[model samples]
Structures are given as C-alpha cells and as structure tokens.
Target: MSTDSVLRFITAGSVDDGKSTLIGRLLFDSQSLLADQVAALYHGKHKRTADGVPDFAQLTDGLAAEREQGITIDVAYRYFATPARKFIIADTPGHEQYTRNMVTGASTADAAIILIDATRLDYSEHTPALLPQTRRHSAILKLLGTAHIIVAVNKLDLLDYSEEKFNAIKRAYSKLASALDLHHISYVPISALNGDNIVTASAHMLWYQGQPLLRLLENLPVANRNSQLLSAPALFPVQRVARLDGSSADDFRGYQGRLEQGSLCVGDSIRIEPAGQNSTITAIYTPAGQVEQAQAGSVLTIVLADDIDISRGDSIVAADSTLQPTRNISASVCWFDSKPLNATRRYWLKHTTQTVYTRIRQVDYLLDVQSLNHRQDSDSLQLNDIGRIQLSVQKPIVATTYQANPATGAFILIDEATNHTVAAGMITSLV
Candidate 1:
C-alpha cells in the first residue's frame, strides 16, 4: 500500500473509558470484520450486554488478564480500511502504570483519539474536571508531536445524551489544551456501546453538527515525509556495513541503512558523523537494482568513494548538513522504570543505531502532567514522571532538536546493570 494512503492513530484514555469498545464498534460498523470474527463475538464465553448483544470490548481485549479485568494493559494494534483511507489503530492502556506502553504506541501516530468518559464527570459544575490520566495522555501526545487530536467524549448515552454535559466537559478540556499548547483539536460526543457518532451520524443527538468519527478520520491528512524539498538535509544512520567477496582484485564495501530524511543522490558529497570523514557517494543500490537517487524512508546500500572507517552506530549525512556532533545535551524525558532516576547512575543512551554510555548531569525539573507546571525542586524522577534533564555522553553523537527532526532527535535510556529500557527522551537542545 502507498504510504500516503495510510493513517496511524491511537485511542487513549483512563481505564474503562471505552477505548476497546469504540474500536470494535468502528470495525463492526464499517463491515471490516469477517464472518468467524462475528460468530466468535456472539458465541464467545465473554458475557454479553443486557440486551443479549455481543460485548464489543471483547474484540480488542484479547489478553486473558485484560478480558478478566476488563481493562487494557498492553498496546493492542488493529487494522482496517475504508474507501477513503486505510487505518492502523493502536488501543493503548490508560492505567498510569502502563504509561510507557501508551507512549510507545503514540510515538509514531500522526493523530490521536483521547476518550473521555462522561459518566465520571460532574456535569453540574460549570467546568467539569478531567481525569489525571486524561491530562497525562494529552501531555504525552503533545510531547510526541502528534499533529491531530480528537476528543472523543464517550458514554454520552449514560448521561441521556445531554448536550450541556458534553459542553461542560469540552470547556474543561479546552482550558487544559490551551495550557498545554495543544493544537488541531476536535471534540465529538460518542456512545461506543450504542454506535453513536462512530461510523455514521447518531439520531439520538442532532445537536452535534460535525462529521462522524469515521468521516473525520477518512478526511484527515496524513503527514507525507516526501513533501519536504529535495534540498533538505538528509540523515542516514548506518545499521550495518556489508562486505561482499568479489574477485581477488575487486573489494566491495557498502553501507546499508534507511534514509530517515531528505534525499541522497549519486555523486553527492556526504560526511560520516562523529568521525567527520567526508566522501562521495560512488553508487546507491536498492533491492531492485541501482538507483540514481533515493528519498526519505528508502532502504538502500550506499557505496562511498573513499574507504574511510565507518560501521554500525555511525551516521552519514549531506556534507553541508547543519547537524552538530555534541557530547552534552538537554532533553525532556518520560521515566518508565519503577526505580527512580538517579543522577549518579550510568545509563546507556541509544540514539538511532548508536548506543553510548551516558550520565545525568542534572535533573532540571519535573513536569506536573495535570497542571503542565514545572517543579524546579525535583532532584530525581520516579516512574511515569516527565522531566527535563541534562545528559553527558561518553562520545560525541550527531543530533538535532526533537522539534527540528524527531527521527534523529529522539532516544531511549537503558539501565546499564539491568539492560532494560528505563526512559524515553527527546532532545530539546544540544548542550
């Protein structure tokens, strides 16, 4: 399938906010389910609704623990296609403990659907307060640079489809969005159980004039990496160095990796990062054969004119690219491990294909997810904590600010002793 024709999005909200049910409803209503799937829903051991209808949430709550507890625990991915667009939906856990899973699912999403349960709110208040998980998910989405956000106010049927309650919840969330500086937001009242405002318009509430959830998704524009100009700086992180055995006189070496950004052409002058070695692109080869040029997202083997030492974890970029090699960096990170972040502990900082030993220079501040406030007194970050911190790597690495280029700018921290990933971070600036 063409990359441009696909849209990747995630459904996130507090536990029991109807994320799974909403996805099941979308798939069922769009006629994307097969006969066996439909039969399993009806005959499955999971309990049905009072009206004897199949349990929609059972379709996505595939894990035994999840089905037993009726809560999402892991990131569940589902795929479906409509006439207008193809969709890859990630159903993420809403529990705070699984915040890391949600971050992993949303990292690549072009858009996000944040579900808000109407039953939990007190509509009598002028501005209904949103749950903390709701705020946390929104904050992560903003940090990940998810361009489009849809506020799905779910279970409105329980509120008798009250327009006032929906408006109150919307008002409360609007303030939160403004504080977080989130943009391109759309609000829709939905009842995943009753199939309202999902794939088609709901007859129960004519007050909402916006398009149904499916229609909006079908029309939302997908981010096309190729849309950038050809002259844009290119980033190619070498994944592997291929050495082919040819004739005794012919020695062949090729660098294999994906073009993360911009373009690469034959005869273009390129520089290897960290080493600062310059070379000319002698040839470019794709799976099909040699190519004169390759754009972003292409996986090809590059043969350079010079035999300068290059290997895995090294990056190749246009010689004129402005990216700087730095050893110190300031970044915003979301701590995922149960153990708090220790300033003196050594960690493995993996960026692109390169993994370097790093130390935390300082914990600048911890961000309050609910209020979007930064606490300056924070010395360490605990599980599910988002904070700004400075890090010093053992070796210089080429990188840019996350806002400038996410592919080359984001990285993960791994515990050296345990080797488990402890945090996900985005480069804010090179220090």
Candidate 2:
C-alpha cells in the first residue's frame, strides 16, 4: 500500500459486547488522544472505583444517547496515525434496529473486529424471541462480507483470566468461521474495560505469547496493487458532470467526471458504456491544478478528446474490459424496513448515480447463521433479516459480484413513497 491510501476497519458485535471500550483502549493507550481530551474523560465520573482504574469506553461514548444509556447507537469515526501506518476505525451500533447502521459501516471496511463476551458464551441457551438476535447466525453471519477478522474474546476478567475459557470460546467461534468459509481470522483474549493485552501485554496470561492488539493491528498484512488495484478493470463512474457554461470557438465540449477505478491518463482511448461512445483523454484536472496523469481512487475532473454524451450515472471503462451490464441480478439483501420483504412488491434501485425501478423475483434461501445452513422455507424477511433474493430491474445497470469488486457490487433499495432506504444489498451473484 502507498502512503496516500488508507485502510478502514469496522468493529461489530452484539449489544454490550465491548466494542466502544476496545476502540477507546486502542486510541488512549496508543497516545492518540490529546491532554485536554484525556483530562475531560478523566473527570467524567469524578471518581474511580476501588480498582483505581478509569473507564476508557467513556472516550468513545460522547453522544447523550450513548452516554446516558451506556450503549452505542450510531457509527463513530476515530482517526489516528502511527509511525508506520494511518488508521480509521468505524465503530458501528450493534442493536438489531441498527443492522442498517452496521452495513453502512462495514461496506468500506478492509477488516472487522468481532468482540464476544467471554462470560456470555452460552450456546445451549436459546434467545427467547427471534427479534433479539436479528440476522445473527452467530458472529459468522454478521461478518461474512468482511475480508479479514480479529475476534476479541473480551471481558476475560469475568472468567478469572482463564486460558481454558478463552480457548474454548476461540475454538467454538473458529469452528463457526470455518463452516462459513471465513478466512484469515485470529483471536485474542482481553478485558476491554480494564485494558489488558490490548495495547499492552498481560501478566495474567503468562502462558500465552503473541503480539499485543495494537501490534497486531499495526502489522496486519494489507494487499497492494498486485491484488486489488491492478488486477481489476478500470471503471470511472461519473459522480457529477462539470460543465463550464459555454462552449469554445467551435462549440468544443468535454465530459467531466472522477476516476472510480484503475488509472486513466492522457492519450488513453476509452469507451463510454450504454452510449457506445469512443473518446481519448485530453486533460486531467485536480482541484489543485492540471495533472498529466491520474490513478485509481482519485477524484479529478476530466476532458475528453472527442464529443460524447457522457453524463452523471454513466460509466467510462477501458476499451478491452467492459463490466457486465444486467437487468436481472441476484443479491444478498439485508432487510432494513420494519415491514417484511413484500415478495409481491417493487421498489427503486439506486446504483451509484442511477436509479431504476426493481422488483423481487425470488427468495432462494435464508441463512441459519449458527450452523451456517440454509433455512429453505422462509416466506418473508422482516427488519434486519438477511436472505438471498433474485431481482429484476427496469433498466440495465453495471455491477459485479462483491468478491470481484466491492464498490461495483453495491446497490440501494429506496421506498418510492418515502424515499427512505428500505434495504441494503450487495450483488453476490449477477444472474
């Protein structure tokens, strides 16, 4: 990875699962907070318990809803820099009503930290109502979209810091991970609220030897050009059409848009899809000034060599690598509406800048997260219910399966009457 690129990670788990405290520990013990900020946090309760330790989760829980209720309700972003790397942590809410919030956070994350309470490792007991654990097939289902994982079996103090207890939880979670085809997951036993084995090593777990949590985060392997940047096709989705009032002497026009994929440079011949227009890059202008070249992830306005009817909601791609365009597709939909997925219903599909009408064609199977099996006869999926749905759109849109390209695989279902987001979906298989 280059210095300009940033690796984003999201923290997820059940309510009271210690997500906030873990993140607060990462920031505080790494010396990321300033003196005044630290002082404010120190005086929150104005007194410490007999343990003489300040509650670190106080740092991240700033909103009154979070502080008063003592639970995370919204996504909070934290930024910090180490000598070797820069990091962005997206702390998402864990309540079932906020499953949409979890999806909102995880969509851009390169990794996920799944925190599990060691004391609440009860598999035999069933949650009385299905609503309590909506869409969770255990932790695995909540995290299948994530590329990498770090399972923090937190609150080890409640377990007397026992290695046996930690290992049991680890083994069980690992088994569920393997069943879900979740890869590259590592585990650590730590007490989030107390800050042991997170930013520093612990004396209680003398038998265990490994990098501390902060060290693990700093050294985690990140993929570079060879995998994500270079191998994929060049895609430039028009976010906006930058028009400069009038045309030149001969009515010369240029289509302005940002590069959304691989590098695009001057003199490179590209084709605009759906329109089938051919053009060459004539100029690249960053807000700073004109640049001779640009690469993936850059937001620059461009000028074309030939006249083309390019507009927002359209895409420009490399001549040789045009992504498949489709009207019917299969997606992994996480139901976000209070009402169940009305199978006989239709909604608006928003992909990038384009919005089209769409209808659910079929519901293949819903996942049973714990066992990671398919619950075959699901009639409907209510709020936070995740299931496989076949969709038929009114117009063709460009998208690849998430495994191929995450940004391209995304789409949104909007309620036509309310204009509210009703579902968050990822294109799992483009049919």
Best by TM-score: 1
Q: In candidate 2, how many clashes are counted?
A: 2
Window of ten residues with lowest summed lDDT in model 2: 126-135
Q: How far off is residue 143 in model 1, in Å?
A: 0.3
Model 1 C-alpha lDDT per residue in residues 80-138, reported as the tens digit of each score: 99988899999999999999999999988989999999999876679988999999999
**RMSD of every prediction:** 1.9, 3.4
Note the Cα lDDT for every prediction shown: 0.90, 0.74
lDDT of 2 by residue, 43-96 (tens): 665322234465666777768778777777788889987776789998988787
Reference-based TM-score, model 1: 0.96
- lDDT of predicted model 2: 0.74
